[model samples]
Target: MSASNQGRIGVLLVNLGTPDSPQTPDVRRYLNEFLTDARVVDMPAAIRYPLFRGLVVPLRAPKSAKIYQQLWTERGSPLLYHGLDLQKRVQEQLGNDYLVAFGMRYQNPSVESALQELRDAAVSRIIVLPLFPQYAAASTGSVQEKVMDIVSKWWIVPSISFISNFVDEPGFIETFAMLGKAEMAKHDYDHIVFSYHGIPERHVLKGSHNGYCKLGNCCNSYNKNNRYCYRAQCFETSRQLGKALGLTPEQYTTTFQSRLQSRLRDPWLQPYTDEVIKEYPAKGIHNVLAFSPAFVADCLETTIEVGEEFKELFEEAGGKHWQLVPSLNSEPMWVEAVAGMIRRN
Candidate 1:
């Protein structure tokens, strides 16, 4: 690469994918690919493949398709479009010298194609930022693994870097805090919930640095020791947002949601969002605002699951009000935060 091209750095932003459309067949195709990833399921292929394809996808696709329909907008999947816009804005921030591209770990606008775009740009170095603020094997790890698998086959691989996590990034926390503060001012919510997507307990143990995470209160504190622990990072992000928004410990709680079905009774992070919402009413916490910090964009999980289904549950439990704090989505601060991460890397 020439000196001019050497300065032409490429930044690729990766996000968890969505179905190509809000239809059953497309949803099933997406579910099949997403669920079958070894990083995602992590079970013996003999058992995992059969169960995922035979029972799970077939049974769940239609229901999930309906949820996707609810989440669909005029531009289609919010996740994909927001991701695209983020890519554009970050590129604008970096100017013409940097090539900023976006890709999905699965489904449309794949990592492979995005890599090709960077390669075509003839950039000397590449920086990949997985859109998940907190790291997990199922999300960030999977994206890193796929990127390497593709780049390894290239005739020449340029210098490539990966940002594994950004849970405590100041700008990131500030963006979420800004959103939460706006919601707090809008409603006199009785309690606040930071609801993150749930992963199997085993997954945490597998990623634990020398078994540091006991999957207990040790995860409540964030430090170099438990830095990569997904649960710990989630709590840390919550605490930072709480501090920024001037929320008391008694007024807010962190919970997990969207756990997939498993044959074994392995526990995921708790208290479950659905269960917590139901309990809120009985605890005299009638009005609440929930945040899905795991997601940067409103999708099936954040929009349909937390915003819709959880609201229904809380209302059914006699809660007077249930509100969902929207995800960052292409917010100006979030875009700037992402650009900062790329520039810093």
Candidate 2:
């Protein structure tokens, strides 16, 4: 191919999706597609297939739709809006050299569409960056799988590269710390909680390197064996952010949130969010600040779960104050950080 025909470089930003509408049918469609993914649910189809199709989707969709409705804005899903904004900001930062596109893994503006846009643009080199800062089989791995799957059928596939996880990236950590400190300065918080979205224990073990991850101190302490470990990554993210914010180990805690039903001996990150809120009073911890660094965009999880639900629980538990640090959204600094990452790659 001629040099002129090779085309521009392309960057696709992918995120977990939101429903097409705040309606049960739409939510069901989105949830069914999301939960059915083997990467997300992580159970064999023989087991999860019926459970997802027959039970969860049917029962949860309507309820989830209600929750999503509460999160919807004039522009539509907060996730979609912020993601679109991020795309524009990143593109503007990178100037005209790169073609930028955004996609939701489970809904409209699908990965297929995004990839097609890049392909049609004749992008010679394509970079896939999942918005998830931390890597998990269900999130980053799934995005990678989908990208490869789509490219596999193409007549001419571009030179594709995937940015797996940038949890420890200097710019990313700095952005997170800056946000956390800004939130903390507003009040005297006795506890700073780093709450990450939870994955099933089986999912963690599945990714473990020959039983290397016990999901305990072994996971918390940084070591080569557990370097790519998702649980470990969460801790490291918390630690780095704490250090940047000048928080001592005693002032901060790391835990997991949003766990679905599962029976596994291996613990998800300790001191679940609710438990942490409830225990804080007894421990003499009054004001609490929560940071959900795992999420790059504000969504139902951060808006409803952390902002409202957890705030209610914390207040009801005799805690004086409960505050949530907002997601990065389209902050100029965050856009610059992401743009820097793309350029470095």
Which of the numbered candidates is closest to the native, going by highest TM-score?
A: 1
RMSDs, each prediction? 1.4, 1.9
Tens digits of per-residue lDDT, candidate 2, 1-345, equal 543576778999999998899999999999999999999877789978798889888999989988988998899999999999999999999887789999988988899999999888888799999999989999999999999998999887879999999878887888878888888777888888988998877777888887898877876676778777888899999988889989899889898898774532355655688777787887888798899989999999898999899898888888889889989999888999999989889
Candidate 1 to truth, TM: 0.97
TM-score of each: 0.97, 0.96
Tens-digit lDDT string for candidate 1 (47-160): 989988999899999998988888899999999999998998888888877999899999989999999999998888999999998999999999999999999999999999
For model 2, the superposed segments whose C-alpha errors exceed 4 Å read 1-6, 262-267
lDDT of 2: 0.88
lDDT of 2 at 20: 90
Off by over 4 Å in 1: 1-7, 262-264
The ten-residue window of minimal lDDT in model 2 covers 261-270
